[model samples]
Target: MGEGNFNWSNEVLTRLISQAGLIALKLVLIIVLFFIIRALGKKLIGSAFEKYQKKNTVNAGRIRTLEKLSINVFSYALIFFTVVTALSNLGVSVTSIIAGAGVVGLAIGFGAQGLVSDVVTGFFVLLEKQIDVDDYVTVGGLDGVVEEVGLRTTQIRGFDGTLHFIPNREITTVSNHSRGNMRAMVDIGISYDDDIDRALSVIQEVCDKVSAEDSSFKDGPNVIGVQSLGASEIVLRVIGKTENGMQWAGERTLRKRLKEALDVNGIEIPYPHQVYMEKKADI
Candidate 1:
């Protein structure tokens, strides 16, 4: 009887060891398969995009944005599948776990509604081509150039070099400034004593010269006549159209050229002044 008891104990121990070894082996295989699949999937995605890029007449920036978003989505899916597979290999009931997760997700559906909205908004944003990488836009009360447009969030780099990540749902209205020709404008105030027609003539000459020389300009830096009458001077406005993202630099150059022209032509740009009287000694 003692010998039989020993044999039964050995048999149980052997079965347990075999089962544990099998589980370990399967886990290793799962990990290996996960990495192999991930690499192949990424390679396939890259090759597909490259082919599409050459064949399709879409903007490269938009294509790149889509590629990055696709990779993110692929990674998320792979991780989810890997986790589920690993759990199943451990003898866990994936169906039961998924059902439990569904119930819990429902329980907190109200709280998760924002996430859903974000995804939906992001989808529409992409579909409508509202914004693209490198596009300067104002949204969610922030002004910046878009760095990346993702499924959940959009990254924008501000003028001051601060990077901002904004949720898609919050971007209700987008003002894309890089869509067409940009306006380059500068306002110069000249003294009332200056000749309006002469000022206008010299300014137009300079505008004509700039428009001829600067290939960056799409249109003239012409003086738009008298913009306003200030307290001490008449404000003359120089307006020009330039390629997108060139407005600031173009405006600066235009302002410098106008100032030089005005100075050379003896047109006095107005400035604040005060006069003091000394009557104490006389009294």
Candidate 2:
């Protein structure tokens, strides 16, 4: 009887070792598959982006965002499936766990409504192409350049160098300034005593020069006539169309050129002036 018990114990030990080895092998295979899928997924996303970029340079930012999102989604999906398969191989009931998770998820769905909304909104944002990475936009009352559009949130870098991560659902209205040509408007002020016609002529000459030298201008930098008559000066408006995101630079360059042209022609930019009078009390 003692001999028989020893043989059974030895058999049990060998079977346990074999089971452990099998589990280890399965785990290793799962890990290797995960990495392989990750690498292939990234490569596919990169290739897709490259092809789309060659066809649509203007939408490069959107394409990049899409590529990043696709990679993230692919990685998560692969990891989740691989882990579940590994668990099943290790004698765990993945179907039961998934069912339990579904019940729990249903219970928590109400509390996670905002998260769901954010995800849904983000998906639509990607589909609609309302805003793209690097696009200057005003959304949720904040103006900035979009850095990333993720599944749950969008990142924007403000002009003040502040980075804002806003939930996608919060973005109700988007004012995209990078879609088309932008208007560059500069108002020049001159002393009222200055010749209006001469000032206009000088401004026109400067505008023509700017239009010729600067490639940013899409339309004529023509004088839009007098904009307003201020208390101390007359305001003349210079209007032009520039490629998106180049309006500010165009405006700055045009202002500098206009100032130089006016200075050369002896046109005075108006400034606040006060004449003081002093009367002796009763000399």
Candidate 3:
């Protein structure tokens, strides 16, 4: 009786060890397959975009934006399926769990409508080409350069270097500034006493030089005559159409050149001033 009991106990122990080994082996295989699939999926997505770009005259930035979106979608789906598979491998009844989740999700769907709206809105935004990565845009009352556009949120880097993640549904109106030629306008003032005709002539010479030399300027940087009469000066507005994203730089260059030209011609750019009078305490 004792020998029989020992043999039975040993058999049970061996069976449990064998089952444990099989489960471990399965987990390892599952993990390996997950990594392999993720890598292959990203590689395939990138390859497809490159091929499409080569065959079409599509905008390079738009292609990059779509490529990133595709990769994000692929990764999200792959991770979800991988987690489900891993859970099933651990002896969990995935089918029953999924059914239970479906009921819970249905109940919670109303409160989560914003998520669905975000995804839908994002889809249309991408489809309509309202904005793209690296675009300077004003959306959701915020102005910034778009870094990424995802299903849930779009990333914006502000001029002051703040990174913002805004939901897609919040982007009701999009003002894309990087689409085509941008207007560069600079308002420089001269003293009310300075010669208007001389200032205009000096500015026109500058404009002609810029139009001839600066490749960024697509249209006139011509002096647009007097814009306004300020308290101490006459404001002259200079306008130009320049390459997208170069407006600020073009304005800076204009201001510098205009200042030099005005100074060389003795046209004083005015500023606020105060007159001081000394009162003697006792004479």
TM-score of each: 0.86, 0.84, 0.92
Q: Which residue runs does candidate 2 get wrong by more than 4 Å?
A: 1-29, 55-58, 272-283
lDDT of 2 by residue, 139-175 (tens): 8999999999988999999999999999999989999
Off by over 4 Å in 3: 98-101, 278-283
lDDT of each: 0.91, 0.92, 0.93
| Candidate 3 CA-lDDT value | 0.93
Q: Give the TM-score of candidate 1.
A: 0.86
Clash pairs, candidate 1, are: none
Q: Write the per-residue lDDT of candidate 1 for residues 230-272, one digit (tens) a residue.
A: 9999998999999999999998888898899999999999888
Every model: Cα RMSD to truth: 3.0, 3.6, 2.0
Q: What does the lDDT read for residue 209 in candidate 3? A: 94
Distance from true location, Cα of 238 in model 3, Å = 0.5
